[model samples]
Each structure stands twice: as C-alpha cells, then as structure tokens.
Target: MLFGKKKDKVHFNPGNRDDGSHEQEIDKDYVEEEVNKIEEDDVEVVLNNEENIDKKFSGNNTLSKYVELGRIMISMLKDVKNGNYKNIPWFTIATIVMALLYVLNPMDIVPDFIPGLGYIDDVAVLTMGVGWIESDLHRYLDWRMENDMGI
Candidate 1:
C-alpha cells in the first residue's frame, strides 16, 4: 500500500540495456525511456489486472486450461531465471518477483503438493500473477512502440 501511494513519482534505472532479442531474433531496442515511471508502477505495468481475471475465468473453469496455463507460467519463470526468455524484460521482472513470493509464502490458497488438487489453486493464482506481469510488460512495450524503440 505504501508503494502504491508513491508509485506515480518513483522511477527506477532508466538506461540499463540488456542483451536480448525476440523470437524472430530481431534486435529489440528495449531501451529504458524513463517516462516518469517508478519501480512500483513498472511492476503493475508488467501485470494484468482484475479485468483480465474476469476474461480468463469468464466462460468456464476448465481443469485443462489451468493445467496448460500453469505449465506455461512455470516454463516462463524458468526461462526468465535461466536467461532464455529474455525478450519480455518487464514480464520477466514480474515473473521473477512472483516466483520469489510463491517460494517465500507457504500459505497459498492451494497446498503446494496435493497432486492435481493442490495444483488447482496454485495454477489459478500463478496464471493471474503472470497475466499481471504480462500486462505491465505490454505497457512498456507500447511505450517502446510509440517511441519507435525496437522493443
């Protein structure tokens, strides 16, 4: 909550460039434009919001969707941590943060080891977390596009 209050005025590093390319191997500019964006703002910018939750859970809560999404989210985290999924910088940042939380907090909605049952809650929450991260990344990507950056 404290971070939320000061998000509008806080900006993190603005010129740190990474060595990454997109799937097409295109050299994404990926420059830090420092548009008055803050650390907390960047975090939210990389994540999806409540609206996405409604959409993702709109029609029906299928088990398979959860399984597939969970796998993808997990894979994304692994890639980010391993330096493979390097294109989505903001997304990677969010994923890494969420993974840290998941590891530190033991009281998640679902137990971490009840086979398929335990996975239900974990997948849902993690999927949402990744979505938020993705949203934040999109915000930055849009900024990049508008500025004609390669990102």
Candidate 2:
C-alpha cells in the first residue's frame, strides 16, 4: 500500500534497452515478499539441523578443546540462568546462546560432517565468544573460586 495504487498486472523488462524507454520497474512488495520467503526457508533449514554436535564430534582429535569450551559455555549459561551470575547484560546471554546454537547447527561456515575439518568453524566461533565475554567469564570464574563452587 505504501506504493499507492496497485496495477492489476505489471510487465518486467529483462534488461535495459538502448532506447531506455522500457526500464524495469520492480514492485517493492514483490521483492520484499521474496526476500522474506527466502529468509524463512533458510531459518527452517537451520532449525532442522540443530542437534547435539558433541555426540557427533566427541571422538574427533580436535574435540577436547571444543568439549572444554562446551563445558564453560554450559557453566556460564547455568550461572546466568540461575541468578548466580547477577548483573550480566542480556546481550551477553544472547551472544552465548548464539554461539551454542552455532555449535549445534550442522550446516555452518563449514559443514560439520566434513572429514578432519568439520569443527574448525565451531572452534573459531566459540573462541570468539570466549574472547567477547572474557572479562565476564573471568569474573564468574573468580566468583566460583571464592565461593568454592567446584564443578
């Protein structure tokens, strides 16, 4: 409706002609609808691939580091969720969740099923996340040490 009156049908030119009289006029609504449809489909694909990445990669040579990162991520999330890690910003929690989600996603920067290189992207993303909240993670670690909350 933002485009004012609607035409019953509109013709689209494949390309610009030399005369330039028949220039393409794309409907904004049509473009927007197509983009939204594509995005929705992509989200569905991502959701379908969300599963346990650890189980798939647990036996991998490079999995130890990822498993440790997973433990740290889980601990951080639990602390935040249980109110043990108070005053944390919502964006921090969101970032952690996004990293975890990426790890769980089978199709990411590099597909997780690839032999010998599947977890490279996962490590990169998780490491970036660890760096992003370095100070917060340190604070939580210190708190745990002070409170004697081992494990």
Candidate 3:
C-alpha cells in the first residue's frame, strides 16, 4: 500500500490474428472510457513527456511512421491549452490525450521491453485515434498553415 491506489490495467488487443480465428479489435469502448477520464493534468503530463515519446518513436522502426502524427497531436493539444484553437471538439482533444497516454505508457497492452513487436499496440492505438479524428486533425493542420504555426 505504499504507492497509493492501484491503477486498473486496460488491455488493447492489436488483432494480429494470422490464423482463421476471429479476434476482437482494439476496444473502442475502453478507449472512450479512458478518454472521458482525461483531465488538464493528463494533458500536461503528455505535453511534458513529449520528448520522451518522440524518442521512443524515433528509436523504433515500426513506430517511426507515427512520429509526425504524434507531434501533430501534441501541437494540437498545446494550441488547445493555450486557447489559440477553438475549432476542435472536446472528443478529439480527449482522444488525442488518450492515445498519447497509451504511447507514453511502456507497460501497456504490449510491454515495450519486448523485442521485435513491442510497439505494435502503440501503433494500433495511434492509428485508431487518428482515424477517429482525421477530419478535426485535417482542420487543425489547415488552421496551423493559415496561421503560420510550425508543425
């Protein structure tokens, strides 16, 4: 009982079923529940750990492709925090936060210590989050360009 309350472990199934058996995809309901729990402090934690997250992406071949998207999400969150961007929906912000949190967590669905396929779940979560907020992300990109905000 030294570490306060125990955090609930949530698993994200990467759906890597090469066999003929059906596998459940990443649980959207679980993700939504986590997103709903996002608070200002959570946003700050992600923003503060941005460099660490970037290092993880840069060091991994599979996660490298998502570095740009991760940066964009962080940028969007920064803008939202600064009150410079008001066009984004709360859902988009929450989703971005949730994805970043997942990426930052090394002991997630797939532990980051595993070689070869450690970051697969992280990639899956990032891809899923981007898909959900693609339009809002695009709009944010456009706004950034129009307002001379560097990516």
Candidate 4:
C-alpha cells in the first residue's frame, strides 16, 4: 500500500522545490512501515542484482560516492545470511535493504534516466540510511576486522 497498491515500486522526493512551493514532504511513518516489510528474500534479490546495482552506481559520479558504503552494507547482509555475523539488529538490516532496493530501482523519485539530477534523491536515501545505521555499521566493521573478513 505504500505506492497505492503498486507493490513493485516506491519513490520519494525530499527538500525544497524549484518554484518555491513545497511539493510533498517525505512520509517518514509510511516509509518506516514499508521498510519494515522487507524480508530476507528481498535482501537476496538485491544481492542477486549486484551487477546492475554496481553499474548504476558507477554510471553516476554522485552515486559513486556511495559505492563503498553500499558494498559494506551488502557484505553485512551476506554475513548475516551466512551466520557469520549476528550483532546487527533486524531494523538495521531492513534499513540497509531498503536503501539498496531504492538504489536498484532506476525509476525512483527523480528517475535515473535523467542526467545530473537523477541521483540526488538516491544519495539522500543512502546518506540517511547510513546515518540511521552508523553505530551498527561500525560494530559490523569492527567485527569484520576481528574476523579477518576483507572488504
């Protein structure tokens, strides 16, 4: 119900508008509701589409900044799947999956086909997701180092 019965797609637009009028504010509650719906299979889809996701990130300079962080997030999910790491909370995992899913979708808020401006929202989502999960991510990093898991 997040996209009015459009189960396959979700989009978000944030910040001020060009005409000096607020178009729409991101519905945080709705977003949280949808993100919480994400499951392990959803995360697996993102992992399975890693090639396409990497292409999307590498195709845009702005999105490229998030590539490393995205990799780390994906790695953490893989670790959780393999039972190699379980310190992360499900909410954190869900958040990461949501962000990755957002990135994988080309027809997002701004539509990736548009040059220059398309990736702005993606960067925002990735940045927000990272901010939300920073502590858990750091813990995962520490655990990664201790386990000699190179990333």
The candidate scoring highest on TM-score is 3
- List the candidate numbers ranked by lDDT, top first: 3, 4, 2, 1
What TM-score quantifies how close candidate 3 is to the native fold?
A: 0.81
Model 2: residues with Cα > 4 Å off, grouped in runs: 1-57
Q: Provide TM-scores for the models.
A: 0.32, 0.61, 0.81, 0.78
lDDT of 4 by residue, 1-151 (tens): 2111223333334334334322123345565676778866787887898777777788656556688888888888888777788776667777888888988888988898887877777777777677667899999999999988798
| Candidate with best lDDT | 3
What lDDT tens digits, residue by residue, belong to model 2 across residues 57-151?
46776577777666665675666545676755444454455566667778976898887777777766666556556677788778879888974
| Model 3 score (lDDT) | 0.77
Query: Candidate 3: which pairs clash?
Result: none
lDDT of 3 by residue, 1-151 (tens): 2112223443434355334321125666777678777766777888999998888889767566799899999998888777788787666777788999999999999898998778878887787778778899999999999999798
Error of 4 at 147 (Å): 1.6
- Candidate that beats the other on TM-score, 2 or 4, i.e. the better one: 4
Q: Which stretches of candidate 4 lie over 4 Å from their true place?
A: 1-27
- Judge candidate 1 against the unseen true structure and give its global Cα lDDT, from 0 to 1: 0.40
Q: What's the best-to-worst order under TM-score?
A: 3, 4, 2, 1
Question: What overall lDDT goes with each candidate model?
Answer: 0.40, 0.54, 0.77, 0.73
RMSD of each: 16.0, 15.7, 7.7, 7.6
TM-score winner between 1 and 2, please give it. 2
Clash number for every model?
12, 0, 0, 0
